[model samples]
Target: MTVAKTINRKLVKTITQRSLSTIAPQVRIYEVGPRDGLQNESKFVPTDIKIELINKIAAAGIKDIESASFVSPKWVKQMSDGVDVMKNLPRAPGVNYPVLVPNLKGYDTARQCNVEEVAIFPAGSEGFSQKNLNCSVEEGLKRFKLVADQAVKDGLRVRGYVSCVVGCPYDGPIHPKGIAKITEQLFEMGCYEVSLGDTIGVGTAGSVQRLMREVLTVAKPEQLALHFHDTYGQALSNLLAGLEYGIKTVDSSISGLGGCPYARGASGNLATEDLVYFLYGLGVNTHIDLVKLMEAGRYISNYLGKPTESKVNRALGDRFKNHNDIAKMASCDV
Candidate 1:
């Protein structure tokens, strides 16, 4: 099936009209910094700093934020205090704060916290499915159904995620049909939207476009989001391919902080700063202050004691220091 066949008539018209106009506006950036960005940290980030980081991120005008996860503490240490994070953070007015919920128990926890939006994920590759969740695809979907059903009953919006959609660490390559099947199941299970993730970051633009060709058959672009990892330096390229297919929503992390545990050499998700820069360059409004975003990334990276993985952040830092040094030299001459 073609791209045109997958998107709804209204969505296609909207995308085409937007793409044609030079003054075409904003791109929605789903901030996955708190959840996806911190998941791979070797050290525990203090809860205080985590709250502070989230506050700063919201202050920077990020409208959609993935705040935390409701998974078992034993499995994801970074989100052990998921409930506390939900309770303490200064909620951004009009912002949508979604949390990751693994199963029915997670949904119950999120409901107790009064969170209305939650996300559940399944692996696109069979090997990854076993390694990540210790089950077959059929069993995982059964588990996801429990969460998705409860979420809807509780008046919560559920977002579905299919990880390793393009390539898998254990499985060498993925067939697009597999992506279509998982995505269709998620949508059928009451997920309002599904995000396709290139978890191992091995996708190219051409391959991604082709894979999307199959996925869009069963899911509308409006009901889908793209999550690309920069492991092979192809995240942006793959993102462009999605854009061409009229995918509007994207998940990105601030400063590109996390990496895949299953794929040793894989890089983090695409950085929020770079996404904003690229969107702005394309005359797309993200409503994000790029300079403020850089500051937010730098603040967290300092606490983490690591150089930021974002190339845009690194260059911007160098430019600022260079200008400051130049100013000092001019002052000395005076």
Candidate 2:
């Protein structure tokens, strides 16, 4: 056989071998665009705009959407209108809106807005915790514990976020054991689910696999979710590793907006459009309409006067343009 034919045969054999192991049948996309995706904007988005964005995202069939953050406006001015956004949100049955609560004060603010669920973040790297939260890792966890306890007492479901799971801007690479410890603490503190964030977006498939192996020891795959940034272009690859490890939930932003304020060079969260496209190819049901989701992305991107950061969305748009051109040519011929 020719070299090209031999190479093609080897590639086919590799794919067939890999396909023998079935991927998960269903994936829960946790949309954080309105909250995490917009928090980093230089100019504050209007409350009306934020509300409309949330409504559009919900209409796109994303059940779990992080709507806003209850943190101090002094720290994140973009989210100053969190209360108004929550109060004015068009409530839809079966859609659960969760807000980020930084401390007990934030939790109180979220409760006043009648938030059904709240998420608290703790940094896996000590340096990042100190830099981001202005406190040591131990102190940050203590604060999170207080908030988590009170949130549970108030009958609210709590979600935990551990940032810089793979590497940190300040501290460099993070050991998997450190991530496991924090994840275990969050679960023990009554968090229903813990999301592991590659805050700086520096994780590769090998690093992600190593981290997952350690984290899965203390927490089950069912209790965990993966949150990755696309800074290094490894977000999708890292997500594939997570899926292979039985993680069914993922956190993504719409149109790939927003990045970590503390991590200077970090990019936005993994784009929801891109994640959905990847999942669909694997036969994983996300229960979200791609067209509707793209519309939402386009609306928000246009409102912000920025091009979409989602590769899948851009490619789809290009494909549509080509099809339209072909149709126009056919019409002229007729």
Candidate 3:
């Protein structure tokens, strides 16, 4: 059956108005630096630094920040202190902190902390599903469904993630059909929004356009978000393709701090600095202070003992060295 026949009627509005050449005047950048960016680190980032990193990012005015992930500490060592991170986090007004909940147990733990939102990640390819969650795609979705159900009943928002939307490191090529099916299921399971991820950073503009065609069939642009990895240097190009589909919410990390475990360090998501710089140039309103954002980026990068992977961050590196030199950084970046 076509998507119109299979998906919810409320979501099946006019398809003719689905594409756009220019981005929306207002865009929402979902900040994932504190959780996804720090998940695979060889050393555990102190809870102090994690809270500080998240607070600093919030201070820069990002609305939706993915602050922590409630996964097995055995698998993701850096996120072991998820509880402490949540407890110690200074509640910021107008800022929503969403955490990743991979299972029902994780979701239960997170709910006790009074989290307003939770995200569930399911893979597009079978190979990745097995490696990442040790289950088939179908089984993983079933697991996330339980979490989504409870989250809704608890009066919390549920966000879904479909990883490896273009291609997977282990699974190779992914057909748009699979992504559409998964996206539909997430929506059916009560996900308010689903962010499609190119986990290994292998997606190109052509691939994104093709994949989004199928995705938009099952999902409204407003109900979807884009998350691209920059490993192949095609993140901006791929983002443009998603923008054409009228997807205004995008996932990004501070200073490009996260990377796929398969790849080297800190190369996964699009750098928030680069994304903001692009949007600002386009006259898109993100309501984020570019100068303060770089300061936050520099904070985490400095503590991580690695240089920032953001091109925008590097171009203005000199200014960040002197935190109070906001004037210098602004002159250099904007």
The residue pairs found clashing in candidate 2 are none
Best by lDDT: 2
Evaluate all candidate structures by whole-model CA lDDT and list the values in order: 0.84, 0.89, 0.86
User: Residue pairs in steric clash, candidate 1?
Assistant: 26-285
Of the two candidates 2 and 3, the one with more favorable lDDT, higher being better, is 2
TM-score of each: 0.88, 0.91, 0.89
Give the per-residue lDDT digits (tens) of candidate 3, residues 292-322. 7888888988887888888888887645544
- State the lDDT at 233 in candidate 1: 91
Per-residue accuracy of model 2 over 99-192 as CA lDDT, tens digit each: 9999999998889998999999999999999888999999999999999999889889999999999999999999999999999999989999
Error of 1 at 11 (Å): 27
Task: For residues 134-209, write the lDDT of model 1, one tens digit per residue.
Answer: 8998899999999888888878899999999989999888999989999999999999899999998999998898
Candidate 3 achieves a global lDDT of: 0.86
* Model 1 misplaced stretches (Cα beyond 4 Å): 1-25, 318-334
Summed backbone clashes in each candidate are 1, 0, 0
